[model samples]
Target: MTPEDLAPDVLTDAAAPIDPARVSDSLDHENTLKKDFVRRVRDCLEAGESDTVYDLVEPLHPADVADLFELLDADERPLLAKAISDLMGSEVFAELNDHVRELLVESLPAGTVADIAEQLDTDDAVAMLEDLDEHDQLAVLAEMEPEDRAAIETALSYPEESAGRLMSRDCVAVPEHMSVGDLIDFLREGHDLANEFWEVFIVDARHHPLGTCQLSWILRTPRHIALTDVMKRDQTLIPVLMDQEEVALRFQKYALISAAVIDEDGRLVGQITVDDVVHIIQEEAGEDVLLLSGAGEGDINEPIRESYLARVRWLIANLLTACLASFVIANFEGTIAKMVALATLMPIVAGIGGNAGTQTLAVTVRALATNQLTASNAWRAVRRELGIAVLNGATVAVVIGIAVSLIFGIPRLGAVIALAMLANIVIAGLAGVLVPLTLNRLKADPAISSSIFVTMTTDSMGFLVFLGLASISGLVG
Candidate 1:
């Protein structure tokens, strides 16, 4: 459609114009879009009132517009996009959830997708296209300008979740020889420079980064001073192949606003800003937790098939681990038959032990992710966790023992269970800390497999220890 086709028409009697001041009515106190507003949009879309839908959505922020798309039914998303096509700009697309954006992008023509891609930062653009199948990806790339195409193609060459794909190609880099006056003039004249940058990189003739000058420093420094004099000689330079999680860690560690990304030869290539790092931090944090639970991305928008596949494998693995736990219990069936209460109380020991293991696993995984628990302090972290586990075990065992003895009037049974609880909890703690550490040492994702192994250890051991004590202590008779 031509620009004229999208021009705002005068408000009709059928749909009155929305007052800007009343737009807050669309959102709740927490800034989430109200269900009533969503219902109104859905009603308009169904009624073929496209103009009213546009008016309702146009006043919302780009992020809100993206949220509205996600809130709508999948079938209705394209209709909303169609009605407010002019408002579906790069910012809205950038803010969109991956699955929702993919759905919209796939429905649009290749040229339209290309146009949206062109308007996005290189990182955001690559994110939008990387998930497309190769054929469709090539079609969109073929429609983009050569320079933009080259930038995206180069970014795609890097491994997924690497800094190369996350960094924006647009950054301000100037020769070190240039004076502050010359730099300012160049920035003023350089229409093609990056639209937003926190710092200006000073590079040598070969485009090797020498230092970085914050925009504030540049503005405050004397114009006649050499760029080198005002720039900080010590700066964190991100290697192109560094994992995006590591990049986020560096940003968090150094409190960086922006950092220059470098090639193998140490030449400046792209820059990663804090805004991009914010998204990386959130993604990695959520990914690790979901992976630990075997939940697979945990995004509600994720396709049913993909979510099912990701979760089923873990469930199957858990099933196998659970069989191992059952095997331990099978060996104690005679003892359980002798003492029927054993069946009632055994689950408490196993369940509490499993909870302890999970707590330790979470702390260890987070420490490993943040580089807090490395080889240097690995043993210290393990000992610290073990210490905490013992205290927790003792406290819980005392409470459960007193309650079981009073409730069942069997002091021997209570003593047996108390000892079993303590042993199982300590075992759980050891497994929790050691499993992830071993996985990390093997160059595997500690978060992915740690929970499976830890849960197996806790469940199997809890049953074995509790039942063995019951049998040997004569509590079963």
Candidate 2:
């Protein structure tokens, strides 16, 4: 039966009544909800009791409701949605994970989806519509109020993940010619405005943002002062096409509370507040980390099919790279067979080197992401990694060398392995830093392919160094 078939009272009765104290404790004690709470919610949905489910879930904060939506099984979501139709507010939609929200919207009727999108801010409305199929998107847009539809359509015209797409259109902007008194009077005159704003952008006749005057400054300055006179001219005006990451960097670099988003002709369109930047910072940081591992997004709320697709391609690339390393190892098979001990000791060298390379790769990727490593200091950073590698190799060589010598009772063999260890590790350090740097130079996403290539280099080189050393030194008869 459909989700709508569920009766509200049945849902409430089926849901195990959770104590308010328990709910409070769950929220306070952990960043995520307990499984029992999720089970109860799920059971309520499964029982087809809409009223009971609504009563049980109605107390949750919007974010918590979003989290609950994410935690539910895909098949159960529509049922849950039907059970708590009234509770599904704009705040809940805002908090829902991108993938889950998209799924929920796609599952609902076009008119229902449009009704929800109309309630969201312009940026969020654009985001909600952007992911839908063209036909579905058009259908939903057609159902929205004309003004909101136009605003969203205007935002959608910009590139995805840009300031134009991310910034809310509901911002405060006033003509630069207005006096502080006029600005204050305008604010007091009760024009419907955004719920919050840190600064008011001063725009010219053509709508070009001339400067910005913070609310604090306007409140403290003399009422007779012209807004243009007091406003800071050197403001960080974000081009509508600027990427969200760059937008965050601008906010961070200038310590801006709010910045004006300008269109192609430098006309002020909207303002991006620090709150928006906070989400951008979080999303971009997480994206970088996941991309470094070739994990793609890595959101738990992601659909199974999408997650599988994201990771499978990376795994396939890794498998291919692994085979290349195997080919290198095959070339040294004779040496390994002659000295069985080589097989035992060989993995240690390669594994250690791989670990070392990974450590360097992680740091380098992070540095590049934060713009801490640049052309001016790239060589300096590379040199520093080289020096660190030398120290690490030396320290690890001494320990492994002595241990191998005592265990195998062969001093010369120990020396050969030790030398190999030193060489492989130094190579690991070099490859780790250089591979990503090279990828960056090639204009590739260094995070996506660097680890695979770096790992391959360390593993192949590690095996070759240890086995080649052993063979050349006659340690393997």
Best by lDDT: 1
Name every residue pair that clashes in candidate 2.
Answer: 7-50, 8-50, 8-51, 8-52, 10-49, 11-49, 12-52
Which residues of candidate 1, in runs, are more than 4 Å off? 1-19
- Writing each residue's lDDT as its tens digit, candidate 1 over 225-245 gives 998777899999999999999
- Whole-structure CA lDDT of model 2: 0.84
Q: What are the Cα lDDT values of the candidates?
A: 0.91, 0.84
Candidate 2 stretches with Cα past 4 Å from truth are 1-28
Best-fitting candidate, measured by TM-score? Answer: 1
What lDDT tens digits, residue by residue, belong to model 2 across residues 1-477?
A: 542343222112123445676467446466577777788788877777767777777667778889988989888888888778766767778888999999888887776777777778888788788999999999888888898889899999999989999999988988877999999999998567877888888888999988888889999999999988899999888999998988998898889888899888999888888988999999988988898788888998877788899899989988998898789889988888887888898889999999999999999988887788877899999999999999999999989999999999999888988898899889989988899888888888888889898888888898888888888897877
